[model samples]
Target: MENGTMPSYFYFTLFKDFVHMRYLILILTLTVYLAILLFNVIILFVVFKERSLHEPMYIRISCLSVNDLYGSAGFFPRLMVDLLFDTNTISRTACFVQIFTIYTFAVWEYTILTLMAYDRYVAICNPLKYHKIMNSKVTALYMALASLYAVFSMGLAIFFSARLPLCGTDIARLHCSNWSVVRLSCGNSTLNNNIIGFFVSATTVFLPAFFILYTYVRILIICQKISKEFRGKALQTCIPHIISFVNYSIASFCDIALSRYDSDKFKFVALFFSVGFLVIPPFLNPLIYGLNLPEIRKNIACLFQRSKVGHFPK
Candidate 1:
């Protein structure tokens, strides 16, 4: 150690705390990660292969699945590696990349959910104009815009964070994030970085969140005046999305709230809560949405049956 100063790379202590249970946790973590990957891929394949499922609504669902996959990809590989080794350190460059990937995935998710809510609103509230409102070209455009905006928003945060001079490099968790890296900077730079980070979150996160809630509320108000059959259809379409939305929102809140409060009394809270957001959505979205939607489920059944037929030739 030079001058007893911090290193250029940051070390994580997330697994050290659970050394006795590391193997079990690793096994469980791998299982969950695999499940998430498999299910999301199945959803993507089903939607891609099924012609009937090519409608705008299912396209948005597929995009949501893609978002889950992207988010999981940003974390799981790195996490699994950390679990397999004693060293839990990440270089500054790699940390910033992870921050970009995970944050963009998160922001993209919020945007897509907002987009989906808007799609549903248009479809139900103005059924006659669903075609005009969510046309293929328009849906594609929205998805592209969501992705672009997410990257842009996250890029700004990472750029500002990179400008700060590091005074320490001891990140205290299972993974790296913008805040973790920013916290290492000294003095006024730290405050300015935090202000930028908070601004980005407000613009990219809370506003979209507000729009999602507003759209759903409007949908609910409109539902009250619609026919029972139409309301039923709307509910069926929305419930799965709503469940994922709530799951993600809760996990994100837990992570943000508990991140700075890492007292002895709250040991493991930050690690679990921070990682929970990444784990829950990817695994949960496919199971909930795939089964709940009839066409995708039917396509999945057909795919398996075809595999069976091919395997056992008469």
Candidate 2:
């Protein structure tokens, strides 16, 4: 070997260690994300295959499952690949696309959650009008509007973010989120931040939170006027929605906090919570609703029995 140069074996060992860590993180993330994805798919299948689950609440739950599946698939797989292969570099165009896709999925998720809250409000607080209010036409309109809003809002955010010239090397985070990319721009990002922040907060966070809260409050008032047995059932139906609201609140706050923070430690914590908040609720939502509502559980059991029988026979 040369006198001033290190041996090839030393470089090999260093590279091996880095590769080992990357592989470990990739495996862990893949396993977790796959489990979540599989559970969501199972919920979707069970809902669609079972004719009894064609009600408004279950339809909204199916929509939420679909949204969660797309949201996780959009970001987590690319993130895992980047982490595992040491392909930390992303082209400007790819980064903008990633940011746009992630934001679009996020907006859809919030809108669906709000729609679910409205569904519950109608079912519990105005049972007589539930069918008329959440009929096929209204459901279709809501879904179409939610899809359009997601695309439009994300397009605007991405357009503004992409217009800025990026000159920095340190992005600090694993994914190219809106604020992280904006913060790295060469020019002033104040205008972009203000516009994106206002829209995001108004549409995704504040509006949804307000509706969820308002719906639940109305449900509570209706429950009070009903018989004790009906009141108990109403409260039970609300438990899952309340849990989801809390999860959304935490995640929304964490998202905003991560955008505002410069500390790597806090950012990492916020990222972890954000991912947890997104993944756990979707998986848990079906389980919670199924256990509390006997019809869903019966349908799921029937589905499993049919699967087993089909596999066993000729």
Which model scores highest in lDDT? 1
Model 2 agreement with the true structure over 1-314: per-residue lDDT tens digits: 11221111111111223455677767877887887777777778877877778887888878887877777776688778777667766666666676777677777777877888898888887889999999978998988987887788778777776666555545555556777766656645547666785876698768878888898889888888899998887777778767766876677577677667764556446446545645566557666766666777777777678788785212
User: How big is the positional error of residue 22 in model 2, measured in Å on the Cα after superposition?
Assistant: 3.0
lDDT of 1 by residue, 1-314 (tens): 11233356787766678778777878998999889989999899888877888898888888888888888988988887877885678887788888888898888888888888898888878889999988999978887887787778788778888877777777677788788777777666767777877888898779988888888999999999989998998999988878988988998888887766653466567667878889988888899988887778888888889888785212
RMSD of 1: 2.8
Residue 35 in model 2: shift from native, Å? 1.0
Residue-level error in angstroms, candidate 1, position 187: 1.5
Q: Tell me how candidate 1 scores on lDDT.
A: 0.82
Clashing pairs counted in every model: 0, 0
- Model 2 CA RMSD to the hidden true structure, in angstroms: 7.2
**Would you list the clashing residue pairs of candidate 2?**
none
